[model samples]
Target: MSTQVCIIGAGPSGLLLGQLLHDAGIDAIILERATLEHVLERVRAGVLEQGTVELLERAGVGERMHAEGLVHEGFAITREDEVHHIDLSSLTEGKTVMVYGQTEVTHDLVERRAQTGALSHYQVEAVDPQDFDTDHPHVTCRIGGENIRINCRFIAGCDGFHGASRRAVPESAIRTFEKIYPFGWLGILADVPPASDELIYASHSRGFALCSMRSHSRSRYYIQCNAGDSIEAWSDDQFWDELRRRLPAEMAEAVTTGPSFEKSIAPLRSFVAEPMRFGSLFLVGDAAHIVPPTGAKGLNLAASDVHYLFEGLRAHFLEREDTLLDAYSQRALARAWRAVRFSWWMTTMLHRFPDNAPFENRILETELAYTLESQAAKTALAENYVGLPY
Candidate 1:
């Protein structure tokens, strides 16, 4: 088979790129190693930056999001028993975030792709992209116990961290920087009203806690835990109790406890592979970078990468210009590094470090204090939280 572009992975990034290319009258096909059920069942970040919201609209998949997603003009940051609000809209000149689950976004995109008759092959195995360095690129994979090859002009790698796309590149060609945090987040999803009207990031003597929601009735809460902690060690009641201990007394009193439907422990890390574009095999989303969920930039960063990559692809195909295509890596990396810094800073400021010296602890305390008390600091946080311009 021959096409203009061959995309790997059926996750949001790959699907979004395919949709955008299709809308532009460009031909592309998506390949996924996992089943359709697996992709849809994965629960991920819910926060949406303004640029992400706009991109979804441009892709014609924002109707359901705008209708069901919560619009948050601000969220709260707490130190000990004190709660301070960061007004995102006022701080960022009428900018706000939307609270919508990543799962729902993927579902909308999947449905739209199906409606448009875009080609997506799920449950394929041994997928590989070859000859990306040359003018002609091709992908080989095993589908239904049969080998297949697809020739294309370019290849897009959206298969994520462990995907074959990045693995196809030689280690000597890519430079990766990574930091593993000493802690992880133990999060649970429950069918109960949120503890507050808006999300809360709390730093207490014990640890860090976050109060977030998937909707008005479904709450997603998390608390810092040991990096090696096991989910079996935590019960529904125990998780709720620990979360309450880290929140303010009033907010704790308002937390509605119930059996959790989903629970997991995710280790925090900041990772970035420099030069997101490896010849014609352009790495998008998790294939390129990862941030601690503290800043809620995981999915948003992926969307931004998609935005840059789409623009580059559009220029190359429609206008026969390679300027945007050549600059994809530089442009995406600039924004990605900024987010990585913000996520690292937020994670450090909000979490209790096990190896912190007495002076370092004092500095972290002061950092939160100053951020809440000073307008300049608050504006900086709001700007990064709402997202930097794409």
Candidate 2:
């Protein structure tokens, strides 16, 4: 097979970038190692910043989201039995964040790409970027059980954090920045009404808890757990019990547990690789960086990367400007670093260390108090959570 571009992974970054490139009359093929069903069922980030929604709107994939999505004006920071609210509208000047799943966005892109009759293959095993030529590159892969080779002018490594494509790039040239948190989150998606009108980031002696909703009938809640905690150890009843404990007294019974569609354990970590591009290949989404789930930045950052990567591709293929391609790595790194810093900061603030040291406890309490009492701190968080603006 031969094309102008070859993308690995059918996730949001790859699918959305393919959508943009297809709209620009640029041809590309996406290869995925997992079944479409698996992709559709994967549960991840649910928050979309203002800029991401706008891009989706322009791409015509925003119809379903606009109809079904929940728009929020602000979120609260809770500590010492008091909740400090940051009005996103007041701080960001009219920007709003939408509660929409990354899977839904991928579904929209998949349907739209199918409507356009673009080339996309699922259940592929290997996608190797061979010799690189700036104007022409080659990808070797096995789709289903057959080995196939694809030649292209450019390659997109959107496979994800534990994907084959990222390893294809030599390790010597890549400098990775990473940090691991002492705790992780155990989350459940239940068909219950939400406990609060806004998402709550609660700091308690037990640990960090998040109160968030998925839909009117489906609510998502998370509890801070040991790094090695297992879902099997916590039965449905235990899950609900922990949720009740971590939540404030006022919200003890505000949330109910029902049949849950998804149960997941996500470890907290921040990771980023410098220079998202190497020769004719480029990386996007999880392949380039990963933010801890605390700040709800995973999907939003992936969307932002696709925006810049697609623009860089457009610059090279349509406008004959290679300068943007040369600068793609540096441009993406800037935003990636910012998100890394924010995710780390939020994680450090909200999570409780196992040591339970007196000094660490004071630091956490002090920051939480500042967030609630200081308008400047609240405004800063409001601006970041809403978005960085386009």
Candidate 3:
């Protein structure tokens, strides 16, 4: 097969990129190792930065999101029983975030792509990108027990951290930095009204907790847990009990808990690979970087990466300009590092270190207190949370 772009993975990043390129009259095909059903079943973050919402609109997939996604102008930060609000809209001059699940975003993109007749192969195996550093790049994969080769001018590596795209790059060509936290987030999805009108991020002596939601009737909550904790170790009752303990008294009492429909523990980490572009291959989203979820930057960072790459491709194909393409990595990385820093800072301030010394605990408490007490600090948080300019 021949196309302008051969995209690996059918996740939001790859699918979003494919849709954007297709709208520009560029030919692209997506390859995925999982079936469509499997993709839709995976749970992910729901927070959307303003830039991400705009990008979805640009791709003609924002109608459902705008109709169903919740908009928030503020969120609360809790220290023990006291709640402090960060007014995002007031601080950022009317900027706000949309609380929409990534799953819905992917579904919209997938449906649009199908309507447009874009090619997508699911359940493919042993996918590999070959000759990405050369003028001619191609991808080889196994589909239905048969080997297939796709030749394209550019290869988009959106298959994520564990995917073959990053591994294809020689070790000497990339420098990676990573930090794994000692704890994980034990999260649950339940069909009940949220505890509050807005999300609440709480820090307690016990640990950190977050109260979020997918809609008015569906709530998602999380509490910090041991890195080695397993789902089997937490029953619905125990999980709810632990979560309520982390929240302030009023919010905890207001929470409505029922049988959880889904439960899992996700480890927190910050990772980045330099030079998102390797010759004809460009990495997008989790393929290039990862941020801790404390600041809700993971999916937003991916959206920004897609924005940069899409602009570069659009310029290359539509305007016959190579300037943006040549500068994709530097531009994406600049914005990416800022988010990484924010996530790291939020994580450090909010999460309780396993062996936190007395001095370190005091410092974290001081930082949180200053953030709540100072307008400048709140503005800074709002700016980063709403997202840095793409």
- The order by descending lDDT is 1, 3, 2
Candidate 1 worst ten-residue window by lDDT: 274-283
Off by over 4 Å in 3: none
| Per-residue C-alpha lDDT of model 3 across residues 4-118, encoded as one tens digit per residue | 9999999999999999999989999999999999998878999999999999999999999999999999999999999899999999999999999988999999999999999
What are the lDDT scores of the predictions, listed in order? Answer: 0.95, 0.84, 0.94
Q: Which scores higher on TM-score, 2 or 3? A: 3
**How well is each residue in 1-390 modelled by candidate 2, as lDDT tens digits?**
899989998998888888889988999999998999998888877889988898787666999999988999998767636667778888878888999878788889889999999999988886788876356679998987899999999999999999877788788978888888877899998888888888888877778889898777778889899999988898888888877777677876687778777888898888998879888889898998999988888888888888888888899988999887787888888887877777887888888889768988888778777777888887788888887753
Regions of model 2 farther than 4 Å from truth:
133-135
Candidate number with the higher TM-score (1 or 2): 1
Displacement of residue 347 (Cα, Å) in model 3 is 0.4
Per-prediction count of colliding residue pairs?
A: 0, 0, 0
* Residue 253 in model 3: lDDT: 98
Candidate 3 pairs with clashing backbones: none
